[model samples]
Target: MLCLYNFIRTTGTLKKQPVYVWMWFTGFIFFLITYLESYLWLIPYFRNNIVNDLTIQWKSYGSMVGSWNMLIYGCGIYLMDKISGTQTYSYSKTGFAIYFLGLFNLMFNWGHHIYTVPTHGYIKHVSYLVSMTELLLLGRIIFLWRRQMKQNKKHIHQPGFRFYAAADFWIFLTLVLAIAMSIPAINVYTHGTHITVAHTMGATIGINTFLLLAVVFDQLNPLIRKIKNFHRYLLPGFRICNISLFIFWISLIVAGIMKAWWQVHRPEVPFSTMMISLRPYFMMFMITGVTLTAGMWMMLLPVVKQYFMHGMHAKKRMELLYKKRNASLSTY
Candidate 1:
């Protein structure tokens, strides 16, 4: 209780972007459904019920959350639309690609939930393909983004702590992402479990961290510039978290991949058996990351917004984006 009170106090006002509000609402809905399925749903359904009912319930909730997650995909489209309508400082094609790919990865993650559910047959197979498609989409997005950036040979090339910090994150995200995807290929030959878990952590959960890191670093530019020798002072912390993000992304991707493959190959194994296998890794990539990452985000965004939203620079940018764009439209 005290902790919650302190959290709320220190966190201060969390500015609710339209997208952020929708995410909270959807997240709460998903949590409620998860709680019911994991706890309350069992008792009522098990009243002279069989495993079939459980599978049905699982599918139902999976569908529910999956739908909510899909709505987030719609939010990505919203982001896309906003970016397109503006001419000033739009996401580079590369940024747009990464943004879209993030959406693709999330879609499959939802599919993965349904795939593991029992009695989920043809539907599961379809979901698997879609999920795999998500992976391919993500891989392509990253690949293309980098390649196009190289071809275009354009960047602001600014010298600042935030610049270096952002560079560190992207570098880490790229390197770990490569290793994460390769773990499955390596496992096919050597069949090592240790590497496999590391892969999942990197891919799924780590990607989440990287995404958040990118958002934070991008938004932190104003704050970063305000500090003295911000780059030098920030490097140690940036390196530490970037490394953590890299590893976590590695662990998550590997974990999600290995778990999926193991389930497909060994359906007879109790689901709990496989899930238990993941619990330890999940502790690092899932629980701990979620706690710190979400808390930090919910806490820090307020401060960042204060910094980001202030001054003539922001007003100029907003005027360029919304006002100028709208004014031009009127002239047209």
Candidate 2:
């Protein structure tokens, strides 16, 4: 709300603002609506019935997630424009079309999530199409942005740029998985399994976390510059994190596939026996998860400590200034 208010106040009118601003405004509006819609299950009138159940589920899974993804995409685009030193709005038609498509997807993309629900056939078809298109558009935007980056600017915030690159890779990988799962026949096997978990983890940690990290590193460029051999320290953790994440992701997908296969073809098998058979994958998943956490902490701790020291020095300077000001006032 504060962001929306400030944006409107600063821009005066929405017409002149860039595409990202519009995307953010749309995100904020729909996020509020969908977030509120998620709570409708609490009301007696909205509970138990198939219509309300589907509404709540779709709002929770689709628009709620889509809303935040829109916000993040806006931020990601703005970051790319800043880094590449290009006027994204110069390509206004493309930008606006992306915004429109995102909006359409936000509204209708929940269908794939609720595939198991006996909703209208059109809903699933529309969602599957829109979701694929949305992913492709996002991937294309990032690809073009990366291609357009000047060699000189590439070195400006190298660490941050690397994170953005990682996000692009993850977006492509996740898109492939998303496309496969969106197919009705494929979704029957993948939905409600570890594959769904893999999808969630990829989006949350891979895309969202990497994008946010880019912003963080970009903001801390001054401090980063002060540290000698920063990349040397960072590289190990970076490699470990990405490699572990990939392994972890793959393990989940394999586990999901095995579970799905057994459930369909070996229904006579006991759940315990199936779980026992899946032990190795689950063990790998847990180990990789731990390593991923360790890798992130290794990268984050030094940056956090630097920020803390900077804050303390800033506080001391302010204290000294206050003391000098009091002394001057006394003399006067």
Candidate 3:
């Protein structure tokens, strides 16, 4: 449907937005393939041959994840250009570099996810190398952004900017965690632990969620301006959410490390005992989850109300304007 729409509505415009359209199209193909394979072949096959087929399914799952990343990373590229307010970002060499590198990672880094699967040593090594290359681009972006932020202190307050900023911070922090986790030695202990959970959460919530929110808030900027003192309501929730998120993120990491250590060092310990030991971290997770939920509700409620109000006003204005236009046309 989207492809057909793009073909009809965006036939002449693809050149102007090459990277955007390409990523969207490629992601769509990947999603279709992944979905079909999972439903038609992978699941039933796994059920039939539960023992010998696990490794292949693990690899397949990685590629399945890789497929959707095209969509998410495409969003990241689009958001970067949007936030920077420059047409050049997506067109530049740096942009192409980031895009292709991301593509490469999407295709091959699935190996890293299955590092503990007793695969060839080379598979793990190659995936580690590809994964490390990502940090290079990430570092350059952070450096450039820090330099820009130092020069202009005003955009920091914009909700969109703040969200993007949070995403950048997450990229840095998550990259560090990911790099450490990618090591074969580290993967030995942390492979199935909450640390892996932390990595997944960091990527989904920290990076992708922030980027999407930044785009959403940016799109809503006009609506926000029409509302009186909207910032006063938004800023507190934003701060609370991010601060709690940071604390929440750290707690997960600490919990993961503790769990990994206990499982390895004290294999004799009962599963119940381990759960008891991890109760404090779980409690922290619950508290932070409540905070996150409250913060999001607080932030989104006014935005939703204002959006509907503005939409109604816009509809009425457009109707009146059309009526006036028709009257003027009749006079002519």
How far in Å is the alpha carbon of 211 misplaced in model 1? 2.8
Candidate 2 residues 243-326, lDDT tens each?
999999999999999999988888999999999999999999999999999989878888888888889999999999999999
TM-score of each: 0.44, 0.91, 0.85
For every model in order, what is the number of clashing pairs? Answer: 22, 0, 0
Best by TM-score: 2
Error of 2 at 215 (Å): 0.9
TM-score for candidate 3: 0.85
Clashes of 2: 0
Tens-digit lDDT track for model 1 on 1-332? Answer: 35335534664654532333334344444545554655544566454465555555555555454444434333433433332354322234644454445344433333333333355466555545544544555455466676545533433222222332343345445444433433333335323344444443443333334444444454455664565554453445444555556556556555666676775578788878888887767677765465446544543445465575566687888778998788889997
Using lDDT as the measure, the top candidate is: 2
> Candidate 1: which stretches are off by over 4 Å?
1-43, 46-120, 147-200, 203-205, 244-332
For each candidate in the order shown, give its overall lDDT on alpha carbons: 0.48, 0.83, 0.76
The CA root-mean-square deviation of candidate 3, after full C-alpha superposition on the true structure, stands at: 3.6
RMSD of each: 13.4, 2.5, 3.6
Cα deviation at 64, candidate 2, in Å, is: 0.7
